[model samples]
Target: MIWQLDLILCLFIIICAIAAINVKDLLGAVIILGAYSFFMCLLWTEMGAVDVAFTEASVGAGVGTVLFIAAVSKTKRRSKD
Candidate 1:
């Protein structure tokens, strides 16, 4: 049962990762990346790595996502293409 849950979380993480990479909009991609990081943090927590999970949540999902949004806000919303 635990292994199954782990597998499911892993699958979600992979899906989020692919979505983040394939997304064309910078803001959307960054948000997807943040979701991916959040999933990773959940997986780490489930695996008993609370410290690592906390760091991933705080640094990867939290601060990193905010930074990306700030950077995106300063640029044009849509690309020239």
Candidate 2:
């Protein structure tokens, strides 16, 4: 495993996490979090953890994103701050 590639993916994952947390729009945050999950899945696959990556891709990036979007769509979408 190349440490450089791993570092890059880890950086991207951290960036996505921070962006997801800071984003004002609910949908945008959800999208960013989904992206974060995708990066995490990539890292897992790169590390030879294929099963973990598959689960993360299907559950975190897939169903979790869909569920978050659905919930956000049903909300008032207002933030106190």
Maximum-TM-score candidate:
2
Writing each residue's lDDT as its tens digit, candidate 1 over 1-81 gives 289889999999999998887777888888999999999999999999999999999999999999999999998655442
Q: So what's the TM-score on candidate 2?
A: 0.94
Give the C-alpha lDDT of model 2. Answer: 0.91
Q: Candidate 1 has what TM-score? A: 0.89
**Can you give the lDDT of residue 30 in candidate 1?**
89
- Model 1 CA lDDT for position 58: 99
Output the number of the lDDT-best candidate: 2
Model 1: colliding residue pairs: none
lDDT (0 to 1) per candidate:
0.91, 0.91
Error of 2 at 73 (Å): 0.4
In every candidate, how many clashes are there? 0, 0
lDDT of 2 by residue, 1-81 (tens): 789999999999999999988878878888999999999999999999999999999998999999999999999565443
